[model samples]
Target: MTRNRLWYCGITLAVIAVGLASRRFPAMLPAAAGKYPGDVLWTMMVFFGLAVIWPRLGVMRLTVAALAISYAVEFSQLYQAPWINALRTHPLGHLVLGSTFNWPDLAAYTIGAVLAMLLELALRRFAA
Candidate 1:
C-alpha cells in the first residue's frame, strides 16, 4: 500500500480499537458519555476506511461519501426484517448495523465526518 493508504488503515484500526474500548469500558466514563463517542468514532472509522479504499480521493468527497454511508446505515435501522434482525443479534452485526434508530446518531455522524475531513486536511498540511 501507499504511505497515505497505510496511514489511513492504521487510523481506521486505531479508531476501531478506541470505539470498541468506549463500549467495553463505559463504566469508566461519565453517565453522559453513554455511547455517543462510540457512534462518533464508528463514523470516523467509516471515513478512514473509505480513505484506505480510495486514498487518492479528495477529503471533501471522502467526507461526503462517509456521511452518506453512515447516515444510510443509521436510517437502515428502521427496517426490521427477520434476517436482518437476526444478523443484528450477533456482536459484529450489532456494531455495524445498529438495532434501533436515534436522531442524535445523525448528528454524531455529521460531527465525525467533519472531524475526519479536518484531520485529513491537517495531516496533508503537516506532511507538506
Candidate 2:
C-alpha cells in the first residue's frame, strides 16, 4: 500500500483503538471530558478538523458516517433498550457507539462535522 493509505489506516485504527480501550478500561483513558458540553464539542471539533485538513490521509465521508453512527448510538442509549445496550456491550458496539450514551454526544458530533467542513475549506485555501 501507499504511504498515504498506510497513514490513513493507522489513524483510523488508532482512533478505534483508543475509543474502545477507553470504554473497556476507563481507568486507562484520561478523564479528559469535562462537565461542560462546550469542552466535549471542542474536542470532537478538533479531531474532525484533523480529518478534514488531512483528507488525503483520511476518509472524510467515512469519518462523517462514523460520527453519525456514533450519534445514533448515543441517542439509542437513552432507551436502555436491553437488546441495544446488550449489543453495545459487545466489542463491536462498544467501539462504535460506546457503553453509555448521552444526547450531548450528538451535539459534539455535529460540532465535529461542522469543524470538519471548515477545516476542509481552510486546507483548500492553503493549498491554493
Candidate 3:
C-alpha cells in the first residue's frame, strides 16, 4: 500500500481503539463525555476507513460517503430481525451495527464527518 493509505489505516485503527476505549471505560471519562463521543468517533473511523480505501478521493466525497454509510447503519437498526439481532449480540457486531436508533446519533455522525473532513483538509494543507 502507498504511504498515504498506510497513514489512513493507522489513523482508522487509532480512532477505533479510542472509540472502543470510550465505551469500555466510560467511568474513566468525565461525566459530560457520554456515549455521543463514542458514536462520533465511530463515524470518524468510518471516514478514515474510506480514506484508506480511496486515499485519492477529495475530502467532500469522503465525508459524503462516510456520512451516508454511518446514517445507513444507524437506520438499519430499525430492522430487528432475529438473525440480525443475533449478530448484534456479538461484541464486534454490536460495535459496528448498533442495537438501537437514536435521533441524536445522526447529529453526532454529522459532527464527526465534518470534523474528519476538516482534519483531512488541514493535514493535506500541512503536507503540501
Highest lDDT scorer: 3
lDDT of 1 at 8: 80
Candidate order by lDDT, highest to lowest?
Answer: 3, 1, 2
TM-score of each: 0.94, 0.48, 0.94
Candidate 3 — which residues are off by over 4 angstroms? 1-3
The lDDT of each candidate is 0.90, 0.53, 0.91
Q: Write the per-residue lDDT of candidate 2 for residues 1-128, one digit (tens) a residue.
A: 01233443454455445544545566654567533233233334445444545555444563566466556656666667788778788966664446665666667667655654565456457656
Query: 8-120, model 1: which lDDT tens digit per residue?
Result: 89999999999999999998779896788888898899999998888778778889999999999999999999999999999999999999999999999999999988988
Better candidate number, 2 or 3, judged by lDDT: 3
Candidate ordering by TM-score (highest first)? 1, 3, 2
User: How well does model 3 score by local distance difference test?
Assistant: 0.91
Q: Where is model 1 more than 4 Å wrong at Cα? A: 1-3
Write model 3 residue lDDT over 1-128, tens digit each, in one string.
Answer: 23298888999999999998999899988888679999899899999999888877878888999999999999999999999999999998999999999999999999999999898888877887
Instruction: Extract clashing residue pairs from model 3.
Output: none
